[model samples]
Target chain A: MSNLMTNYYEAAAVILFGIGFMNLLLAKNLIKKFIGLNIMDTAVYLFLAAKGYITARAAPIIAQGTAARVEDYINPVPSGLVLTGIVVSVSVTAFSLALVQRLYKHYGSLDLDEIMKKAKKEEKV
Target chain B: MTAVNYIQNIPFFSIFLAIFGGIVTPVLGNGKTAQKVNLVIVTVIGILSAVLLVHLWQREESFTFMMGRFPAPWGNELRAGPLEALLALCFCLVMALTLTGGSRFLQKDVLPGKQNLYFTMIYLLLGSMLTLIYTNDIFTAYVFLEINTIAFCAIIMAKGSGESIVATLHYLVICLLGSGLFLIGISLLYSITGHLLMENIQQAILDLVQTGEYAFVFAVVIGMIIIGISVKSAVFPFHFMLVSAHSVATPASSGILSGLVLKSFIFLNIKMFYCVFTIDLIRSLKITNVLFVFGLMGMVVGSISALKERRIKHMLAYSSAAQIGYIYMGLGLGNHEGMVAACFHILAHAITKAMLCICAGGLIEASEGNVGINSLRGAGHRNLVAGIGFTVGGLSMIGIPLTAGFISKLYFATATIYSPQKMVITLLTLAISMILNAMYFIPSAIAIWSPVDKKAKIPKPSRAMQYAIGIFIVLNVVLGIYYAPIIDMIEIGIQLLES
Candidate 1:
């Protein structure tokens, strides 16, 4: 079972993605949802980076002779792509955190359900 | 180099001007200067895209310009056809007009010190939309997708109420989820096809279909991309967040977000379905009917919800969901005419919805920000410009003859002739939704024009806003009356897209 689990990195990345997606779907608190978003972002990056990995292949280096041999090195495009994904994820996380700070300041709660109940109560006027 | 080569640089210039506007806006230290910058940026882009449209129409050719000096496999690309040019033109005109018409509201609603930030976000949003349309690289589109999402969230939160904050958070989370799913889909595609450029990916997909071993994963990727964009566009089941987000947002932001931002994704979706995977392949997979059912559900549900809602902005927002369904219906029809109708609906809906949202702002101002349906009583009488704009927009939405909305529905009606069985369903959906459209819009139109509370409370709009609304009214009428050339352009554009 352990061998099967570790045999495929793509399966691990996909499972992580499923967990993150489920968290995003079911979480009630705004902060928890933010965490869910971060988790999902990381899972995607993991999946993207895994696409570059090749068994028994060296890192993508162009040291003279082996640079001519395509099979000697892993694909570098996915690694390059992972960098871009990480940057986008960082910006989103920062902005969402700023928004959560303001939400907390206004409602005195981070839970969407509680805040909604209070907001509705306040709107009764 | 020939002059055509320089003329081909319009898309690049349009994108860079917007990026430059975004950077310089905050440093200008005031909203007034920032507004001028926004206007100037959009105007120049609009003119340039219009010029490019004429050139492309005359030449009947598409062009792709490589970024940097990198060789074919490594270089990024900007590709444009008549359709891309026309969309860029519409987006710029609508953004400029909405900004002009809603400037006063922007000054009033936004915190005084943060107005420059608002303009900054607006510019960034425009830049991202243009990039999304012109990008030939898949990764470039995803990066711009995230940028547009963040910029839109900022504009919504620029209103700064508790409700606005909550709305922004909700929209942000949803966007994150959608984009995450989209990223997974792109990775799967790249892994399978080993290509990121759209044309290469298309060829790879064609070859993959021939081999037929990875069919399940291919279908999953297709579903993921469609669902991802559907979430972004607020198609049917994902529409619950749209009403709150659009309504809580300031009127100008609401206008731009609902009008242009959502359409950008739909345009991308059409490109994906048409360019990335030919409609024939999509049809073979039998996903066309699924889109039709979802579109039908959206039309029915969105209109009925609007019929029950009383707030004018919420009603308008719900109507947007329904209008998006109309575009989807066109897409799901699975013919060239259906694609044309969908694209036409994109333009018509953008102009009408922006005009309506901006005019709604005027009505709210006249009523001292009372958003209730009845409070709009005599709002038209009070603010004559708001009254006229609202009536014209409403009529167009309800599909009156000689309006752009009616033409789109007419094209859609003809487009439905492709499938004899679905013809009845298509027409029935249009007729019922139009009635539902009238049920909500007519009442509000009457409420605005009714004579009970005719006293003018809100001051006359600023000169700029008045000019903006005036231009919008003329533009809508022109789009309706002079639609033949536009239709021809879409035909040529679709031809370019097809090949």
Candidate 2:
């Protein structure tokens, strides 16, 4: 129980991840699906951020006029990784949105099932 | 500088050259010009990596080059061993051939204005695959996985049809889910091991294993990584996206996606098994057992699905899933020979499937865009080269003697001899899959060759395409015949990988 409490952030993040994954899977609207994807990405970011943070530790920036020590700061790797993740997620979301926009333009529907029906009809013709 | 010093730069050069080609491609403005540039770039990389393979084989050693001045486990790194170089060489070779072979379709299928952009994506795709092959950092692999996914999605939709567009959207969604899983897995791993470099992580994992702590977390991490990659690679149950995306795309896109892209992820898994967790650890955890079950299911189920597909391209796509199953089956055997078999199958399947896609494109062209198997009757008579190519490719797929596929199957069978526990299941699946392979491939092969009632389009595949298909056929036969040296090379490569 103490271990679970101590890692509550990770627990919350995992739950968020599961919810986002479910939404991504079950949502009919393409935009909503992408929103779910974004949520999932955010959960990942949270998990990574929590992993990188250490209680009472300073940020990774080197202090001026003081000798640098490993103990002075939290691990900066995950922070850099989080930045990379944000960039990746932004691009992915933008790309997915652009695709969804094109899909909407083509079929005039945001629902996947409707678009698929229209596409099948189009193919039959 | 000495030859060794110069050889060390080949991996770096070969990767960035493709990216450089991609960057400069849009300036060319003409799709034709961009394509010519792309071919030149792939060819150059092919030659460079081929040379690197020879150099590495002779040296019998692997080298890691640090990006900029940063050291290991921190800065980015690229490692080249015999295996990496060999796979890179083959990828470059296959990409060049695929582009050349499918250039006509590219010209016809893609929008005129987007042709240069199409070539740019191809260049980037090549760069990303090479990066995936050579990267020593796990995060670098994940980043390139996204790049690869995006580039592939763009190419799939390059055909500019509603079907292709819709297919691309689905593909993008599924691929994002995959990469999202992969990213979280990497974060979890980094949190535990505090190292992103594969070698350092392996050491940390070794210590963790020895201490017998956090075993549950460890299993979750491996499971996440494996499932993420399996999803992307279209293993069995996750193969729904492959059929649509691969079938709807242009022949070039189909060939590259089905042939090379899937194989790269599998290669990454192999690397993780060998370099990240080590084989003994993986086996001890019984992860291979789970993979083994999935492998058998994919083999049997994928082949059965292929048998039921009506469209020629869809059938080929399903067969690819089955072949992926074969590779995974070999991996799941959990022996050194099985790994080698998996690698050989990778090579064999890359060549054979790419040829099959290009040949199918040619047949479709000759038949005036009808992809139905029945409609393809006498497609052989119209485009004889494509007909012969498809026959040979199909034959290879069925494990006919004197083809690359036969050698791989033989290797897999021999590999099963080492693991008696898996022997019965492995052999039974192999036998069943082989028959299943023949059941679909034979009919399709015969259908393309059979007589048709109507007149067929006499579209001759272009000179470049003819040359590309010719080289693919020749390479297939060569590998089938002269496999000893290649297998020896792969063995040496695997040794280098482990060391």
Candidate 3:
């Protein structure tokens, strides 16, 4: 239990992911589902960044005259990956929001259930 | 660089051409120019991919092209084996054919001003698909996967109808969730190995397998990636969104979406499994068993439901789901023969389904855009060429001995021979699915041919559309009769792919 407590960052990230995934599935409102999607994306990014960080480690950059070793700096790859992920998540959010706007226009509601009903009605014709 | 040297870089060059096309096509911004530009672009790309295929085959070894000066695990890279080249070649040709064949539908469906945007989206979608095929970097693959999803959604939206918007929203949410899961899987794998290059990642995974450490996390990652891909590829349970998306999309978009786009996700998974996880690890993990059950279920479920669909396009969409089940069945069998069948089915189904969707669209056009199967009565008589095209495509789907579908089915049957435990179930499921496939397909094919009150003056598909369909029909026959070279190529390609 104590060992798990020491890794709370990861636990938190995983929890956020679980919550986001649940929200995405359970949320009736399109906007909330979209929020859930972003939350999930954000959670993954957090996990990735957390994986790259180490206690007492300096930034990846090396100063001109400093004697440096590999362990002195945290691994930089995951940070770079996390940045890319963030950009991807941002675009996804933008795209979904645009979609939500379209949905709002077409169905006259943000409620997925109502929207689905409209879609079903439309399909019959 | 010398001209020959330039030709040697065809893989990279073709990718560049597609990206250039995506950027340039939109700027041209009109129907005439977009069509002209698109023609030039697709033709050039088709020629390039074919040339690349020949070049790679002749070389007879995998070519690893480094994207920068940085070494493995750092710099980006692209690898070309016979398999990748052949897929790119097929993708280019099918994409071009679908676009050309569906141009009339595209023009009619999309707003006049936004047609250029539609063309732009198409080029970008092709560009992204090609990127996914060639990229050896896992991170690059993910990036391109996002780009591919966005561009595909954009193509659907260019229709600018309420139904398409709803359909695109449904499609996007599903795809984003799938991709998100995939990204998390990638991130987990990266954290474990500290590597993003496919080669390095494979090496790290091999180490884990050898040591038998981190087994639980490994299994979880595997599951995540598989589920993610299953959603993207519309494997069995995750396929509810697919019929809606396809039914609402334009003919060309639907053809490309159902036929080729979905298969690329399967390709990515194949690459991941073959390139990273050894077959031993896969079997030990029992991933194959899971796939086997779901695939069998899909085969039964998809086809049975396809029988109930009233709309022509929707019925075809459901059949595609069942066909995808065949590919998964091949994957689940978990052997070289099974993998080959899956790969071959990808090619066969792409050709058959694209042809079917295009022909269905033409039939609907002949019916004055009535989508219901009732509207299809005597549609064949009115538009003889489309009727013939649809028949040819349908016959191929039925797995007739001389057609491509038979080759896939034959391969699947033979593949079942190796997996003794799965043999009975595989054969049983396959036989039942064929009957189910025939149940839905034969009735619809007959229904379309049966005469009804003739609605006259239904315009036939234009000259170009006819030629494209004719070419596709011929291609299906050629693939069926002369399958030796392709199978051999796949074998050689699979070997090189298994790094």
Candidate 4:
């Protein structure tokens, strides 16, 4: 039964990776690509969390008036790292979105091809 | 956790001050006030870094600081051995030079209202890079990497041009993907090891290898990590993003990105390969051969691209890519001599590339952005100081004798000789590339110095710009002549890595 859960989580992570990779390859809009990247990041976090889970383990938290028991609790380290990873991913996504907004303002278009053409014309002029 | 010991560790304090100064620059400066505050903050941070370096030099042993007093296995730590100290010192010194050299280009190119934003981003970039080299936690390194990427995007936006904005967006996408890969790799390792501490992870991997249960997984994770780092460092195929990004960003931003930001990733690569992964693991996986091949490809492709570039900045950007390939080749050799050569080249390239980028900026400003090679005609007959600086920097790039570049290249070449396959290919390729470098650089050099248009008036740089360029030139020549001290310092650093 534990192996089943692990397999399910692994499949989910792979699906997420696929979606992210596809979006990255196919999406031309910068914002959409970033969304794809976030999805991919979530996939990795899930993989890590799954890797740390064990059979018959409780959440990595101490009960009221009780000391922690390592044998009965899930590993908490990956979760902590995932928290940091989420923060970094969100920061990068926010900054990229901000940059996209700036690019739209400057070029008056969200299309990558249009922007490149416009820049080329400016270079010639 | 132990009580905070902030007063005892000067290097940590200095780094914090530099980062805080960066965060506060936007709040403290506006309009003319911004320039004054930027000058003061940068100067103070520069001096603080210098003092920290001097203190570090006087110490006889390596130092380690645990963040929040977490034990080695559970908490993140910062280690400042000789190598880390030397790299920190290099960053500080380059920051000082770039900040000073940047003023002229910033005043001319940056949108007036965004001056504070520009300086703030520069500070953030420096802070994150310094933090990256100092941190012992893989997760913390990832955080700093993200910070550097975001700050870099903001700096690109400061150019306030359509191309700059588009290029920045592309850079953002690639960096996000790269960081994602890095996180995946780190998470995989953390899950397997149950520890986030770098030293713990190293031991955990070794234990697993001993058990022989997860050797393939370990190799895969290591490959993912290297791939992620290569993307960040803009190696080979991952380099497409950098050319547009660096060439289109403001000249000052380009200087910082090429001179220091990429070098930070290279530093992390060295730490991960040499310190985190043992020699047995590296050899068993045959990773060195893969890296050597990719490095060779980057050197050739980068040179070819650079040779074809018509714009001055584009050429310099491509050249930066090629030079990075050289550093990787040195590291890929994976011997004592190779490691030493890589360390030396890092310093040499930082100084030389910064100088070239600054000179390019000055030339662009003087010509009102007519920076094509053909347009540089008769520039030398005009501004002798800037022209001479550009020539000296160009010669260094070509690995001419009596320059810093030549010293590093010689070491790398000698080290490659230990492996016959590498030596033959590297020597011949580098020889051919040097010729290619001259093919592109010589024309520009001649055009700049030639008296094609004698009557044209040459614009002299301000006192500040002159001082900045003068400092770089003197250091380049001085460092080239007295390279023994630097090599000895790097040897000490390599020893620390081995320990």
Which structure among the candidates has the greatest DockQ?
Answer: 2
What TM-score describes the B chain of model 2?
0.98
- Per-residue CA lDDT of candidate 1, range A22-84, in tens? 788778877788788778878878877777888899887787654368888899999989999
For the candidates in turn, chain A alone yields TM-scores of 0.83, 0.96, 0.92, 0.85
How displaced is residue B133 in candidate 3, in Å? 1.2
Q: What clash pairs does model 2 have?
A: none
Query: What's the TM for model 3?
Result: 0.97
True contacts kept of 2: 0.59
- Every candidate's fraction of true contacts kept comes to 0.62, 0.59, 0.51, 0.77
Error of 2 at A58 (Å): 1.8
Q: In angstroms, how far off is B150's CA in candidate 1?
A: 0.4
TM-score per prediction, in order, is: 0.97, 0.98, 0.97, 0.94
Off by over 4 Å in 1: A1-7, A63-68, B453-456
Least lDDT summed over 10 consecutive residues: which range in candidate 1 chain A?
Answer: A59-68
DockQ of each: 0.71, 0.76, 0.68, 0.68
Summarize candidate 4's per-residue lDDT along B303-375 as a digit string, tens digits: 8998898888889988888888888888777677887898898888898888888888777666656878888
The DockQ value obtained for model 1 is 0.71
Taking the tens digit of each residue's C-alpha lDDT, what string does model 3 give over B1-499? 7754665577788888988987887779687688778888878887887777777677777877878699776888888888998898898889888888888888898877999888888888888888888888888888888988999998887788888888888888888778878888888898898888888888899987789888999999988887888888898887877888899888999999988899888898888887767677877899988987888888889998898998998899899999999999999999999999999999999999998999999999988889988878888888777888898888888888788999999999999999999999999999999988888778778978997875578776698789889999999999999999999888888888975
How far off is residue B134 in model 3, in Å?
1.4
Task: Using lDDT, rank the candidates from best to worst.
Answer: 2, 1, 3, 4
